[model samples]
Target: MPATPNSFSVLSHPSLDQSGGGTLSSPVTRPVPLVESTDLLRGSKTVGIMHNGSLYRLQATKLGKLILTK
Candidate 1:
């Protein structure tokens, strides 16, 4: 089914305070592809819409940035 017009709002994160005691239990947003997986090539910057039609601005992560991938 198609989404109702303008029914979504951009996700938000609150500023963290000392000791990181601000909404730490909340889930972090993961960057998602807009059109297709091909739109975001591994190791390249990508600006596209998610499957849900939400706009996302993303860049591929560097090799050193990842600790593990499973």
Candidate 2:
């Protein structure tokens, strides 16, 4: 990844890498930041996130998967 982001984020994990089709890899010098969905939602099924002048909705699906949309 670039030292600084140039956009193109549609929900990607920090620990995931483009190599090998997005596999998890640990950083040698620093730990990745992690945030639990429950903590973010605070018991709600949906949450609104503001990013780059756009409002996005993050929803928890019935199958327990997360979906983010603008």
Candidate 2 weakest lDDT stretch, 10 residues: 3-12
Q: Number of clashing pairs, model 2?
A: 0
lDDT of each: 0.42, 0.71
Model 2 C-alpha lDDT per residue in residues 1-70, reported as the tens digit of each score: 5533333323356535545655546443443355778888899999999999999999999999999999
Q: TM-score winner among the candidates? A: 2
lDDT for 56 in candidate 1 is 55
**Count of backbone collisions within predicted model 1:** 2
Q: List model 1 lDDT by residue over 1-70, tens digit each.
A: 5644433232335543223776545544543223433344454545443656655555445542322121
Using alpha carbons, what is the TM-score of model 1? 0.22
Question: Distance (Å) between predicted and true CA of 8, model 2?
Answer: 25
The all-Cα superposition gives candidate 1 an RMSD in Å to the true structure of 12.1
Error of 1 at 34 (Å): 16
